[model samples]
Target: MIRSHFDEDLKQLHREIVDMGSFVETAIASAVTALKSYDVERCKEIIESDKKVDEMERKIESQCLWLIARQQPVASDLRQITTALKIITDMERIGDHASDIASLAIRITDRSFFPESEMIFEMAAAAIDMVNSAVMSYVNYDMELAKATEEKDDIVDDYFNKVKHYLADVFSTQPHRMDVAIDYLLVAKYLERIGDHAVNICEWVHFSQTGEHKSTKIF
Candidate 1:
């Protein structure tokens, strides 16, 4: 019956979701840096810190459940609560991919070899932007920002394909580096997967507003 209560609870929900997004972005950044520098120490830190992100995800999920049970949030409010639940799941999986990339960085202990970090950098940049836009869209209920994030996802996908092609060339011709090449290729794949998850969040944001996925172009 109290409107103020619903407003405050939803505000808190936004804070928790934004905080979780920040954690995912930081994990992705650290993982990319670990690969670029071949720094085992940083990679180890990434692996250790992944658990904190996991806990954050659990807390947000619990909050979403509490809100659903306590308040009969109607229509748009119901959609928002469901979207928050879905977004956290995608965010948690993205953290796992980040951890996977960090583990690959740990494999190159002795060699100074690093794959072309620029491609990873590009992917990371697009991913971060997607997260930023998606978070903002969620906070403001801005459908445009949410819709634009899908375009950035395409850019990250292109960079991922390029990295895969270059990795294939290295493995076939410079066969001596096959082991390290595989590691780098996996890192790229993980980053690409993380980007996909980010796009998924954006899709959910759009769905919460429009009631249908924007990605499904309708006639």
Candidate 2:
């Protein structure tokens, strides 16, 4: 009976984490959409949603601690709960990055001052894909998917570099637009950081499945 109850608790914990992941994913999407549309109301909505993400992280952390204290989970079970604790931290930071992007978007005074860069949208898409894959890997306990998602972080990083190069040129040619260019670059930086956090979540997924901090070596 005790084992059965513990199993149910673990299941509930998993469900909660998945829900948090879903919320963060939506936040990321909404932030990017607000940026593209220059929708101040959407940006404000994303900022407000960040508090819910924080609450989700605290709730998950509490559940994980309670499980460790009362259930005394060992071996794979312990690893899974601990991995969740680590994953939630990364997820929370991702939420913050999304909020940061939205905050930056809201600060733009003249949207026409900055030229559109395709790389910005590409970076957002790449980061979102990585986060989605990482969460799905955790939900399904798929080590292969986790490893694959981690590998995609490089794509987002590459996009960030491209955006930086383009922004530098904009600053040189259009000094008057420097402020807007810098704000766009900051958004790119946030997206890059979000991708990094997704990679961290994938690493935790690997640990949860294999009890190893690193994913399986790829030759």
Summarize candidate 1's per-residue lDDT along 1-219 as a digit string, tens digits.
678888888889888888888887888788878777878888898898889889998888888889889887778888888888889999888888888988987885534444466776787778767777777777777878877886788887898899888878987888888898787778777777777887888888888877777556221
Give stretches of model 2 more than 4 Å off: 215-219
Q: Which ranges of candidate 1 are over 4 A from the true structure?
A: 110-115, 214-219
> Which candidate wins on lDDT?
2
Q: Deviation in angstroms for 26 in model 2? A: 0.4
**TM-score, each model?**
0.90, 0.95
Residue 18, model 2: lDDT of 94
Number of clashes recorded per candidate: 0, 0
What's the TM for model 2?
Answer: 0.95
Name the best candidate (by TM-score). 2
lDDT (10s digit) by residue, model 2, range 1-219: 769989999999999999999899999999999988889999999999999999999999999999999989998889889888999999999999999999998997677755566679888999999999999999999988999998999899999998999899999999988998999989999999999999999998888877777645321
